[model samples]
Target: MAATQYMTDGQGPTISMLAAGDASDMLSGYTLIEHLAQNKTAKVAQIGKLVDEQAKAHDQAQQKITDLQKEIKDLASQKKRIEALVKKYKPQSPSVGMGGVTPRMANVKTVIDQEEGPFPTIGCVRHTGDPQDHGTGHACDFMVTTGGVMATGAAKAHGDATAAYAIAHASALGIKYIIWRQRIYDLRSPGWRMMENRGGVTANHYDHVHISVF
Candidate 1:
Protein backbone atom coordinates (compact mmCIF):
# COMPACT_ATOMS: atom_id res chain seq x y z
CA MET A 1 0.00 0.00 0.00
CA ALA A 2 1.25 3.41 -0.88
CA ALA A 3 1.72 4.69 2.66
CA THR A 4 -1.84 5.73 3.46
CA GLN A 5 -2.53 8.16 0.65
CA TYR A 6 -5.45 10.11 2.33
CA MET A 7 -3.91 13.61 2.63
CA THR A 8 -6.35 16.60 1.80
CA ASP A 9 -5.58 19.99 0.17
CA GLY A 10 -6.69 23.06 2.20
CA GLN A 11 -9.63 24.92 0.70
CA GLY A 12 -8.16 28.50 0.65
CA PRO A 13 -4.47 29.31 1.18
CA THR A 14 -1.50 27.38 2.31
CA ILE A 15 0.26 28.22 5.57
CA SER A 16 3.26 29.42 3.59
CA MET A 17 1.09 31.91 1.62
CA LEU A 18 -0.50 33.26 4.75
CA ALA A 19 2.91 33.79 6.28
CA ALA A 20 4.11 35.60 3.15
CA GLY A 21 1.22 38.12 3.35
CA ASP A 22 2.69 39.67 6.60
CA ALA A 23 -0.51 40.21 8.68
CA SER A 24 1.48 41.81 11.47
CA ASP A 25 2.76 44.56 9.16
CA MET A 26 -0.80 45.41 7.92
CA LEU A 27 -2.08 45.62 11.46
CA SER A 28 0.77 47.94 12.40
CA GLY A 29 -0.18 50.33 9.52
CA TYR A 30 -3.82 50.46 10.65
CA THR A 31 -2.72 51.15 14.18
CA LEU A 32 -0.45 53.98 13.03
CA ILE A 33 -3.31 55.63 11.07
CA GLU A 34 -5.62 55.40 14.07
CA HIS A 35 -3.01 56.99 16.31
CA LEU A 36 -2.47 59.83 13.82
CA ALA A 37 -6.23 60.56 13.67
CA GLN A 38 -6.49 60.57 17.40
CA ASN A 39 -3.55 62.98 17.68
CA LYS A 40 -5.15 65.34 15.15
CA THR A 41 -8.43 65.35 17.12
CA ALA A 42 -6.56 66.07 20.36
CA LYS A 43 -4.69 68.97 18.73
CA VAL A 44 -7.98 70.46 17.48
CA ALA A 45 -9.47 70.17 20.93
CA GLN A 46 -6.47 71.97 22.52
CA ILE A 47 -6.72 74.83 19.98
CA GLY A 48 -10.42 75.27 20.77
CA LYS A 49 -9.71 75.43 24.47
CA LEU A 50 -7.03 78.05 23.97
CA VAL A 51 -9.36 80.19 21.85
CA ASP A 52 -12.09 80.07 24.49
CA GLU A 53 -9.65 81.12 27.23
CA GLN A 54 -8.36 84.08 25.21
CA ALA A 55 -11.89 85.29 24.50
CA LYS A 56 -12.78 85.23 28.19
CA ALA A 57 -9.63 87.15 29.06
CA HIS A 58 -10.42 89.84 26.49
CA ASP A 59 -13.93 90.32 27.90
CA GLN A 60 -12.57 90.72 31.43
CA ALA A 61 -10.05 93.34 30.34
CA GLN A 62 -12.74 95.36 28.55
CA GLN A 63 -15.03 95.26 31.56
CA LYS A 64 -12.28 96.52 33.83
CA ILE A 65 -11.59 99.48 31.55
CA THR A 66 -15.26 100.43 31.51
CA ASP A 67 -15.45 100.36 35.28
CA LEU A 68 -12.37 102.57 35.60
CA GLN A 69 -13.87 105.14 33.23
CA LYS A 70 -17.07 105.36 35.23
CA GLU A 71 -15.13 105.88 38.44
CA ILE A 72 -13.18 108.73 36.90
CA LYS A 73 -16.38 110.51 35.89
CA ASP A 74 -17.87 110.16 39.34
CA LEU A 75 -14.73 111.61 40.93
CA ALA A 76 -14.84 114.62 38.59
CA SER A 77 -18.43 115.40 39.53
CA GLN A 78 -17.59 115.21 43.23
CA LYS A 79 -14.75 117.69 42.79
CA LYS A 80 -17.04 120.19 41.08
CA ARG A 81 -19.59 119.95 43.87
CA ILE A 82 -16.93 120.54 46.52
CA GLU A 83 -15.68 123.64 44.72
CA ALA A 84 -19.20 125.07 44.55
CA LEU A 85 -19.78 124.43 48.23
CA VAL A 86 -16.59 126.19 49.21
CA LYS A 87 -17.51 129.22 47.17
CA LYS A 88 -20.95 129.39 48.78
CA TYR A 89 -19.52 129.29 52.28
CA LYS A 90 -16.94 132.01 51.68
CA PRO A 91 -17.46 135.15 53.81
CA GLN A 92 -18.28 138.57 52.42
CA SER A 93 -15.66 141.33 52.30
CA PRO A 94 -15.43 143.87 55.14
CA SER A 95 -16.62 146.58 52.72
CA VAL A 96 -20.13 145.06 52.58
CA GLY A 97 -20.85 144.45 56.28
CA MET A 98 -23.91 142.58 57.47
CA GLY A 99 -27.29 144.10 56.45
CA GLY A 100 -25.71 146.01 53.49
CA VAL A 101 -24.09 148.39 55.99
CA THR A 102 -20.76 149.96 55.08
CA PRO A 103 -18.37 150.39 57.97
CA ARG A 104 -16.40 153.21 56.33
CA MET A 105 -18.80 156.14 56.26
CA ALA A 106 -15.97 158.73 56.21
CA ASN A 107 -14.45 157.09 53.19
CA VAL A 108 -17.84 157.18 51.46
CA LYS A 109 -18.22 160.89 52.22
CA THR A 110 -14.87 161.69 50.66
CA VAL A 111 -15.72 159.58 47.63
CA ILE A 112 -19.11 161.25 47.17
CA ASP A 113 -17.74 164.76 47.61
CA GLN A 114 -15.05 164.11 45.02
CA GLU A 115 -17.57 162.70 42.50
CA GLU A 116 -20.99 164.42 42.97
CA GLY A 117 -19.88 167.87 44.20
CA PRO A 118 -19.84 169.25 47.77
CA PHE A 119 -21.98 167.23 50.24
CA PRO A 120 -24.38 169.14 52.48
CA THR A 121 -23.42 169.69 56.12
CA ILE A 122 -26.75 168.45 57.63
CA GLY A 123 -28.80 165.99 55.51
CA CYS A 124 -31.70 163.65 56.28
CA VAL A 125 -31.27 159.87 56.23
CA ARG A 126 -34.67 158.21 56.43
CA HIS A 127 -35.98 154.76 55.46
CA THR A 128 -37.73 154.18 52.11
CA GLY A 129 -41.09 154.35 53.89
CA ASP A 130 -42.12 155.96 57.20
CA PRO A 131 -42.40 154.76 60.78
CA GLN A 132 -41.16 158.18 61.74
CA ASP A 133 -43.15 159.24 58.71
CA HIS A 134 -45.83 156.75 59.75
CA GLY A 135 -44.65 156.58 63.41
CA THR A 136 -44.46 152.77 63.72
CA GLY A 137 -41.10 152.34 65.56
CA HIS A 138 -40.87 148.74 64.26
CA ALA A 139 -40.93 149.62 60.57
CA CYS A 140 -37.17 150.16 60.59
CA ASP A 141 -36.29 150.86 56.96
CA PHE A 142 -32.69 150.69 55.78
CA MET A 143 -29.97 149.80 58.26
CA VAL A 144 -27.29 152.45 58.60
CA THR A 145 -23.61 152.20 59.59
CA THR A 146 -20.96 154.86 60.15
CA GLY A 147 -17.23 154.97 59.44
CA GLY A 148 -15.99 158.33 60.68
CA VAL A 149 -17.74 160.72 58.29
CA MET A 150 -18.97 158.09 55.80
CA ALA A 151 -22.46 156.66 56.36
CA THR A 152 -24.50 153.83 54.71
CA GLY A 153 -27.74 151.88 54.99
CA ALA A 154 -27.58 149.38 57.88
CA ALA A 155 -31.12 147.89 58.18
CA LYS A 156 -32.79 150.98 59.60
CA ALA A 157 -31.70 154.30 58.13
CA HIS A 158 -29.49 155.34 61.10
CA GLY A 159 -30.10 159.06 61.14
CA ASP A 160 -30.01 161.51 58.23
CA ALA A 161 -26.26 160.90 57.69
CA THR A 162 -26.36 157.41 56.19
CA ALA A 163 -29.13 157.97 53.63
CA ALA A 164 -27.65 161.30 52.56
CA TYR A 165 -24.22 159.83 52.07
CA ALA A 166 -25.53 156.82 50.18
CA ILE A 167 -27.51 158.96 47.79
CA ALA A 168 -24.61 161.39 47.32
CA HIS A 169 -22.27 158.47 46.71
CA ALA A 170 -24.63 156.89 44.16
CA SER A 171 -23.22 158.63 41.11
CA ALA A 172 -19.68 157.58 41.99
CA LEU A 173 -20.80 153.96 42.42
CA GLY A 174 -22.91 154.01 39.21
CA ILE A 175 -26.00 153.58 41.33
CA LYS A 176 -29.08 153.07 39.16
CA TYR A 177 -31.80 155.31 40.58
CA ILE A 178 -30.49 158.00 42.90
CA ILE A 179 -33.73 159.86 42.28
CA TRP A 180 -36.16 157.04 43.11
CA ARG A 181 -36.85 158.32 46.61
CA GLN A 182 -36.44 162.01 45.81
CA ARG A 183 -39.03 162.74 48.44
CA ILE A 184 -36.56 161.33 51.01
CA TYR A 185 -34.78 164.32 52.56
CA ASP A 186 -31.01 164.38 52.97
CA LEU A 187 -29.01 164.95 56.17
CA ARG A 188 -28.97 168.66 55.14
CA SER A 189 -32.80 168.64 55.08
CA PRO A 190 -33.07 168.89 51.25
CA GLY A 191 -35.37 166.62 49.25
CA TRP A 192 -34.24 164.53 46.22
CA ARG A 193 -36.50 162.79 43.71
CA MET A 194 -36.33 161.06 40.32
CA MET A 195 -36.33 163.66 37.53
CA GLU A 196 -38.31 161.38 35.15
CA ASN A 197 -40.97 159.16 36.78
CA ARG A 198 -40.34 156.24 34.40
CA GLY A 199 -42.50 153.73 36.27
CA GLY A 200 -42.81 151.18 39.11
CA VAL A 201 -40.78 152.94 41.83
CA THR A 202 -37.79 153.61 39.60
CA ALA A 203 -37.18 149.86 39.16
CA ASN A 204 -33.65 149.60 40.59
CA HIS A 205 -34.37 151.05 44.05
CA TYR A 206 -34.40 148.01 46.30
CA ASP A 207 -34.92 148.69 50.04
CA HIS A 208 -31.15 148.92 50.49
CA VAL A 209 -28.61 150.82 48.43
CA HIS A 210 -27.15 148.52 45.79
CA ILE A 211 -23.51 148.93 46.66
CA SER A 212 -20.60 146.69 45.65
CA VAL A 213 -17.74 146.40 48.14
CA PHE A 214 -15.05 146.00 45.55
Candidate 2:
Protein backbone atom coordinates (compact mmCIF):
# COMPACT_ATOMS: atom_id res chain seq x y z
CA MET A 1 0.00 0.00 0.00
CA ALA A 2 2.47 2.72 -1.26
CA ALA A 3 1.64 6.48 -1.48
CA THR A 4 3.12 9.57 -3.14
CA GLN A 5 5.73 11.80 -1.40
CA TYR A 6 7.86 14.83 -2.25
CA MET A 7 11.63 14.92 -1.73
CA THR A 8 13.83 18.04 -1.45
CA ASP A 9 17.45 19.12 -1.61
CA GLY A 10 19.03 21.12 1.28
CA GLN A 11 18.42 24.37 -0.59
CA GLY A 12 14.63 24.51 -0.25
CA PRO A 13 11.50 22.39 -0.49
CA THR A 14 11.37 20.80 -3.94
CA ILE A 15 9.08 18.15 -5.38
CA SER A 16 10.58 14.82 -6.43
CA MET A 17 8.04 12.06 -6.88
CA LEU A 18 9.13 9.22 -4.61
CA ALA A 19 7.29 6.38 -2.91
CA ALA A 20 8.46 6.74 0.69
CA GLY A 21 5.18 6.99 2.61
CA ASP A 22 2.35 4.64 3.36
CA ALA A 23 -1.17 5.67 2.26
CA SER A 24 -2.25 6.43 5.83
CA ASP A 25 0.58 9.01 6.45
CA MET A 26 1.09 10.42 2.94
CA LEU A 27 1.97 14.20 2.61
CA SER A 28 1.24 15.56 -0.88
CA GLY A 29 -0.29 18.57 -2.72
CA TYR A 30 -1.89 21.04 -0.27
CA THR A 31 -0.88 19.03 2.80
CA LEU A 32 2.75 18.88 1.68
CA ILE A 33 2.87 22.70 1.06
CA GLU A 34 1.31 23.33 4.48
CA HIS A 35 3.81 21.04 6.20
CA LEU A 36 6.79 22.71 4.51
CA ALA A 37 5.61 26.25 5.22
CA GLN A 38 5.04 25.43 8.88
CA ASN A 39 8.69 24.40 9.31
CA LYS A 40 10.03 27.89 8.46
CA THR A 41 7.07 30.00 9.62
CA ALA A 42 8.49 30.73 13.08
CA LYS A 43 11.88 31.82 11.75
CA VAL A 44 10.33 34.08 9.09
CA ALA A 45 8.02 35.65 11.65
CA GLN A 46 10.94 36.27 14.04
CA ILE A 47 12.98 38.00 11.30
CA GLY A 48 10.00 40.17 10.33
CA LYS A 49 9.48 41.13 13.97
CA LEU A 50 13.13 42.18 14.30
CA VAL A 51 12.86 44.31 11.16
CA ASP A 52 9.74 45.97 12.54
CA GLU A 53 11.45 46.76 15.84
CA GLN A 54 14.44 48.34 14.05
CA ALA A 55 12.19 50.41 11.80
CA LYS A 56 10.24 51.69 14.81
CA ALA A 57 13.46 52.67 16.58
CA HIS A 58 14.61 54.60 13.49
CA ASP A 59 11.33 56.48 13.37
CA GLN A 60 11.56 57.35 17.06
CA ALA A 61 15.11 58.63 16.66
CA GLN A 62 14.09 60.77 13.70
CA GLN A 63 11.24 62.28 15.68
CA LYS A 64 13.58 63.05 18.54
CA ILE A 65 15.98 64.81 16.19
CA THR A 66 13.18 66.92 14.73
CA ASP A 67 12.02 67.89 18.21
CA LEU A 68 15.50 68.89 19.30
CA GLN A 69 15.94 71.04 16.18
CA LYS A 70 12.72 72.84 16.94
CA GLU A 71 13.82 73.41 20.53
CA ILE A 72 17.12 74.88 19.42
CA LYS A 73 15.38 77.24 16.99
CA ASP A 74 12.97 78.34 19.68
CA LEU A 75 15.79 79.01 22.10
CA ALA A 76 17.63 81.05 19.51
CA SER A 77 14.55 83.13 18.85
CA GLN A 78 14.08 83.70 22.57
CA LYS A 79 17.70 84.77 22.93
CA LYS A 80 17.32 87.30 20.13
CA ARG A 81 14.20 88.70 21.75
CA ILE A 82 15.90 88.96 25.13
CA GLU A 83 18.85 90.77 23.62
CA ALA A 84 16.54 93.18 21.83
CA LEU A 85 14.69 93.88 25.05
CA VAL A 86 17.89 94.59 26.91
CA LYS A 87 19.03 97.00 24.22
CA LYS A 88 15.68 98.76 24.11
CA TYR A 89 15.45 99.61 27.81
CA LYS A 90 19.07 99.77 28.90
CA PRO A 91 20.19 103.13 30.30
CA GLN A 92 22.87 104.83 28.20
CA SER A 93 25.74 106.64 29.91
CA PRO A 94 27.89 109.23 28.22
CA SER A 95 31.55 108.54 27.51
CA VAL A 96 33.12 110.60 30.28
CA GLY A 97 36.52 112.32 30.29
CA MET A 98 37.19 111.39 26.64
CA GLY A 99 39.52 113.67 24.72
CA GLY A 100 39.67 114.60 21.00
CA VAL A 101 35.94 113.69 20.71
CA THR A 102 32.86 115.44 21.95
CA PRO A 103 30.92 113.74 24.73
CA ARG A 104 27.93 113.24 22.46
CA MET A 105 30.02 111.84 19.59
CA ALA A 106 31.89 109.59 21.98
CA ASN A 107 28.59 108.29 23.34
CA VAL A 108 27.36 107.60 19.82
CA LYS A 109 30.57 105.71 19.05
CA THR A 110 30.32 103.74 22.26
CA VAL A 111 26.72 102.75 21.65
CA ILE A 112 27.29 101.77 18.04
CA ASP A 113 30.38 99.80 18.93
CA GLN A 114 28.43 97.92 21.55
CA GLU A 115 25.50 97.39 19.24
CA GLU A 116 25.54 97.71 15.43
CA GLY A 117 29.09 98.68 14.68
CA PRO A 118 32.50 97.11 15.17
CA PHE A 119 32.60 98.71 11.76
CA PRO A 120 35.21 98.26 9.06
CA THR A 121 36.54 101.69 9.94
CA ILE A 122 35.45 104.58 12.15
CA GLY A 123 37.22 107.82 11.36
CA CYS A 124 36.94 110.93 13.47
CA VAL A 125 39.03 113.98 14.41
CA ARG A 126 40.92 113.83 11.13
CA HIS A 127 42.44 116.80 9.33
CA THR A 128 40.08 117.87 6.58
CA GLY A 129 41.87 121.27 6.10
CA ASP A 130 38.49 123.04 5.79
CA PRO A 131 37.45 122.78 9.48
CA GLN A 132 34.51 120.47 8.86
CA ASP A 133 32.95 118.47 11.69
CA HIS A 134 35.57 115.73 11.28
CA GLY A 135 38.33 118.17 12.31
CA THR A 136 36.31 119.42 15.25
CA GLY A 137 35.80 115.99 16.93
CA HIS A 138 32.02 116.23 16.45
CA ALA A 139 31.77 113.87 13.45
CA CYS A 140 32.40 110.20 12.83
CA ASP A 141 32.41 108.08 9.69
CA PHE A 142 31.03 104.62 10.37
CA MET A 143 32.44 102.76 7.41
CA VAL A 144 30.36 99.67 6.84
CA THR A 145 32.21 98.55 3.72
CA THR A 146 35.87 99.21 2.96
CA GLY A 147 38.13 99.21 -0.10
CA GLY A 148 35.99 101.87 -1.78
CA VAL A 149 33.39 99.22 -2.43
CA MET A 150 29.81 100.21 -3.11
CA ALA A 151 27.90 98.37 -0.43
CA THR A 152 25.46 95.64 -1.43
CA GLY A 153 23.67 92.84 0.37
CA ALA A 154 24.49 92.71 4.10
CA ALA A 155 26.83 95.69 4.06
CA LYS A 156 24.24 97.93 2.46
CA ALA A 157 21.61 96.71 4.91
CA HIS A 158 23.95 97.37 7.81
CA GLY A 159 24.67 100.89 6.57
CA ASP A 160 20.98 101.57 6.21
CA ALA A 161 20.26 100.34 9.72
CA THR A 162 23.07 102.43 11.17
CA ALA A 163 21.83 105.52 9.40
CA ALA A 164 18.26 104.93 10.49
CA TYR A 165 19.25 104.34 14.08
CA ALA A 166 21.26 107.53 14.11
CA ILE A 167 18.34 109.44 12.69
CA ALA A 168 15.86 107.91 15.08
CA HIS A 169 18.04 108.65 18.10
CA ALA A 170 19.11 112.08 16.91
CA SER A 171 17.64 113.87 19.88
CA ALA A 172 19.27 111.66 22.48
CA LEU A 173 22.61 111.37 20.63
CA GLY A 174 22.69 115.15 19.86
CA ILE A 175 22.97 114.38 16.14
CA LYS A 176 23.39 117.54 14.08
CA TYR A 177 23.21 115.74 10.72
CA ILE A 178 23.63 112.32 9.11
CA ILE A 179 24.98 111.80 5.61
CA TRP A 180 24.35 108.48 3.89
CA ARG A 181 23.83 107.18 0.36
CA GLN A 182 24.22 110.56 -1.32
CA ARG A 183 21.63 112.17 0.92
CA ILE A 184 21.88 114.37 3.98
CA TYR A 185 19.47 114.40 6.96
CA ASP A 186 19.96 117.66 8.83
CA LEU A 187 18.17 117.76 12.19
CA ARG A 188 17.47 121.47 11.65
CA SER A 189 15.54 120.71 8.44
CA PRO A 190 14.38 117.23 9.55
CA GLY A 191 14.26 116.09 5.92
CA TRP A 192 16.28 113.88 3.59
CA ARG A 193 17.89 116.13 0.97
CA MET A 194 19.65 114.67 -2.06
CA MET A 195 23.17 115.90 -2.61
CA GLU A 196 25.25 116.21 -5.77
CA ASN A 197 26.85 112.93 -6.82
CA ARG A 198 30.44 112.94 -5.58
CA GLY A 199 31.64 110.27 -8.08
CA GLY A 200 32.94 107.70 -5.54
CA VAL A 201 31.77 105.36 -2.84
CA THR A 202 33.51 107.17 0.05
CA ALA A 203 32.83 110.65 -1.31
CA ASN A 204 29.10 109.96 -1.82
CA HIS A 205 28.78 108.35 1.67
CA TYR A 206 27.54 105.14 0.06
CA ASP A 207 29.85 102.81 2.01
CA HIS A 208 29.83 104.76 5.27
CA VAL A 209 27.28 106.45 7.51
CA HIS A 210 28.44 109.90 8.52
CA ILE A 211 27.21 111.25 11.86
CA SER A 212 27.72 114.83 13.01
CA VAL A 213 26.75 115.67 16.59
CA PHE A 214 26.06 119.11 18.03
Q: Judging by TM-score against the true structure, name the best candidate.
A: 2
Question: Each model's C-alpha lDDT?
Answer: 0.42, 0.78
Q: Tell me the tens digit of each residue's lDDT in model 1 across 1-214.
A: 1211222234212333334458875566556556756887899999999999999999999999999999999999999998666555544222212232333433443343343222223122334542132121111123222222323353234334445655565555433222223243333334564444324332222322322221
Error of 2 at 131 (Å): 5.3
lDDT, candidate 2, 1-214, per-residue tens: 0122223333222232233355433445436656756756878999999999999999999999999999999999999999988776665433222458888888888777567755876777777544389877898888888799989999999988998988898998789999999999999999999999878888989988889999
TM-score of each: 0.35, 0.55
Q: How does candidate 1 score on lDDT?
A: 0.42
